[model samples]
Target: MRLRSCLAALALVLLGGAAHAAEECPAKSTSMDDIIAVLNAAPGCDRAMKLFEACEYGASGDVQFGEIVEKKCEADFLGHLKPPQKLSYQRELRVCDRKYRNKSGTIYISFTAFCRAEVAQRYSRRALKAGGAGR
Candidate 1:
């Protein structure tokens, strides 16, 4: 429940920079794959959200797990960007959370998941296009 709300808030905040990403590489109609599984064996988003919420609120010793997922997300997202665009995307990624400025720990964690889903879907759609570039 908490993670769900946090994710919603995170999306509104992330919309600012993610909006740029959307403008740069909009998602297309295609088979979407979830990419927030930096954990590889994360099962699904519901479990992942539970992990994030537990990690954030200290209900479990999952802080290290969350950090690893976060780093992986950044790394994976960076892989999709061209050299010239990388800097701008990174800036947008960083600026997203800061601009919205939410105090809830759940918000931050859910934002990570939301952004991951967007990035994954964007890349998936791009791959589905004629030449691996979004239409």
Candidate 2:
């Protein structure tokens, strides 16, 4: 019974350490330009640009600018994900969209900056989750 108790305690400790090792977003903020640089270097720049174009179209008052920007930003993020990662990130993408949905500024620049930050933060977290190696 004592041996079993010790093993159980050890298991919990190991699991707790693993969970702690999973990366969350940094508290230290980054500049919009830095985020943009990261997004430009990421794999989904073309898709992001298309999404940005769609946001621009809607921003011309074809649809609600905020709503379209939010949706397109989420789509751009999801576009970068692999099939397996999509389901995992669905809820997160929605949360990210809602957080930025009502933002107001220059349409192209704002949406680009917003999407860039979102994508950079996602990639940063992913890298940390993979033990500092990016996917």
Candidate 3:
């Protein structure tokens, strides 16, 4: 029951972010920091999260963007959580990693990164929105 409500909250955040993402997605870039910088500006990385999402699906150079975004996004997301939340997130992230652990090279890494970043962003938006209330 609690998990279901959390999932619902996550969905609301992602759906809200998607609309903003569409309008604010940046041009393709070679610099990972460039993308991360933009992502950092968004509480949920909503604007630049699209870039990471699209880049994950891209071949070659695009995968680099996803790799960079995911690492920083994951770190950024975890930075905002408490000790207990971090432990729970690590467990959740392990599940996320397992879902893509089979693929070789950057593809699997980037895919799992995307999955983690997506969840991180959702938590960020919802947590910030509620001012840490009712958690």
Scored by lDDT, the top model is 3
Give residue 11's error in model 1 in angstroms.
22
Estimate every model's Cα lDDT from 0 to 1.
0.45, 0.47, 0.61
Arranged by lDDT with the best first, the candidates are 3, 2, 1
C-alpha positional error of residue 32 in candidate 2 after TM-score superposition, expressed in Å: 14
Q: Which pairs clash in the backbone of model 1?
A: none
**Model 2 CA deviation exceeding 4 Å by range:** 1-84, 107-112, 128-135
Candidate 2 residue-wise lDDT, 1-135, digit = tens: 999999999999999998777543221234433333333443543343433333333232322323333443444344556887776665555565566566675454345445444554555455445555433
**Model 3 Cα lDDT, one tens digit per residue, 1-135:** 999999999999999998676543463464656655555554434544665664344434444554454554554455778899889877776787799667777666666766666666666556556565321
How well does each candidate superpose onto the true structure, as a TM-score? 0.34, 0.27, 0.53
Full-model lDDT, candidate 1: 0.45
Worst 10 residues of 3 by lDDT: 54-63
User: By TM-score, is 1 or 2 better?
Assistant: 1
- In candidate 2, position 66 carries an lDDT of 30
Q: Per-residue lDDT for 127 in model 1?
A: 38
Show the lowest summed lDDT stretch of 10 residues, model 1.
Answer: 24-33
TM-score, predicted candidate 1 vs. hidden true structure: 0.34
Model 3 clash pairs are none
Error of 3 at 51 (Å): 2.5
Q: In model 1, what lDDT does residue 39 have?
A: 39
Q: Which candidate is the best by TM-score?
A: 3
